[model samples]
Target: MKRSKPRLAVFKFASCDGCQLTLLDCEDELLAVAGQVDIAYFPEASRAMAPGPYDLALVEGSITTPHDAERILQVRRRARVLVTIGACATAGGIQALRNFADVAEYARAVYPRPEYLETLAWSTPVSSHVPVDLELRGCPIDKGQLLEVISAYLAGRRPNLRRTSVCTECKARGTTCLLVAGGVPCLGPVTQAGCGALCPSYDRGCYGCFGPAESPNPPALAGRLAELGRGPDEVERLFRTFNAWAEAFRGGGRPA
Candidate 1:
């Protein structure tokens, strides 16, 4: 008997939906992938629905409300393989910036009726509530990497993702060492490789959009930033951008 096609679902909580768009942006590859699996419940792509238990689920957002915290558990129960895509789903994205501040005060300033808002004090990753099989990091994950992950899962193999720092990308692209050559306060030495060293090629520093690399030495990078005239506060702000809550990047530049 022929094996049944796997069911794939895409979920969202609190995000800009850039990651999901990355999936759609895989125009040619997506058509081929679609033939291999059943695109069961991707609201961004189609109105057609398929109920769980799903073979694979791609979640793309942070848990910013109590409802989402509870909802993620339900999604976990339904998915055989759960993968979190993007910084929001893996490290809470830029929204995690609120984790360090007074959320209630910020709410009051933004909303006309803060009391009516039903948000949590902190925005956290999907993994905070459920067990995730994999995490693809980026503000919006790279389309090629996204394809590799999907195909890898279907093939029962690990995705060929690099865990090196963005500095490696610079070296691969023959881009100049912005920090050493220009004295730029770059996070490339600590930030994960994925964006292909896009910023540094244009003479700007890496902003840690893909979060901290595997075993990243953020403290050492912070010291280098200090040498480039960056103070503790400036260094802290740099690490707390797209992947603020990632442990490797956390508390690195705080005063002693």
Candidate 2:
């Protein structure tokens, strides 16, 4: 007897949906992915709302409300394997910047009826609500890495992803060191290797869209940035951009 195709579901919470678009932007590769698994519940792709017990679930976005927190529990129960995609799902994205300030005050100032509003104080990652089997980091995750993860899942193996810093990618692409040569405040030394050192190639400093790499020395990098005439506040602002809520980057963003 042949095994049935595994059902795959993509869930969203509070996000800009850029990561979801990356999957759709796969274009030709998406056709191959379609043949491998049954896209059961991807609202971004199709309107088909297939029922639960999905083999794999790709979750995008952060938990920003009580409803989203509860929904993730249900998603966890139904999905055999849950992989969080993008910064929102893994590190709460830019929305998690609210975790630093007063959310209630912001709401009151923005909305006329703050009393009617119902939202969580903090925008938290999915892992904070449930166990995440794997996490893909980025503002909008790299498509190649996303495909590798799916292929690995189908083959019943671990994804072969590099945990090295973006500096490694820069070296591979023969891109000049923006920080050392130009004295630009770059996050290449600390950011994860996935974006292929895109910013550096354009003579711009890395913004750490892929979050922190393995054993990243962000404090050391912060010191270097300080030496480059970047004040503590400026360095903090840089670190607190896309992956602000990420654990390793969080401490790095703080004033020493």
lDDT for each residue of candidate 1 in 6-85, tens digit (9 for 90 to 100): 99999999999999999999998988989999999999999998799999999999999999999999999999999999
lDDT of 1 at 97: 87
TM-score of each: 0.96, 0.97
Misplaced by over 4 Å in model 2 are 252-256
Best by lDDT: 2
Candidate lDDT (C-alpha), each: 0.91, 0.92
Q: Measured by C-alpha RMSD in angstroms, how accurate is candidate 1?
A: 1.4
CA shift of 191, model 1, Å: 1.2
lDDT of 1: 0.91
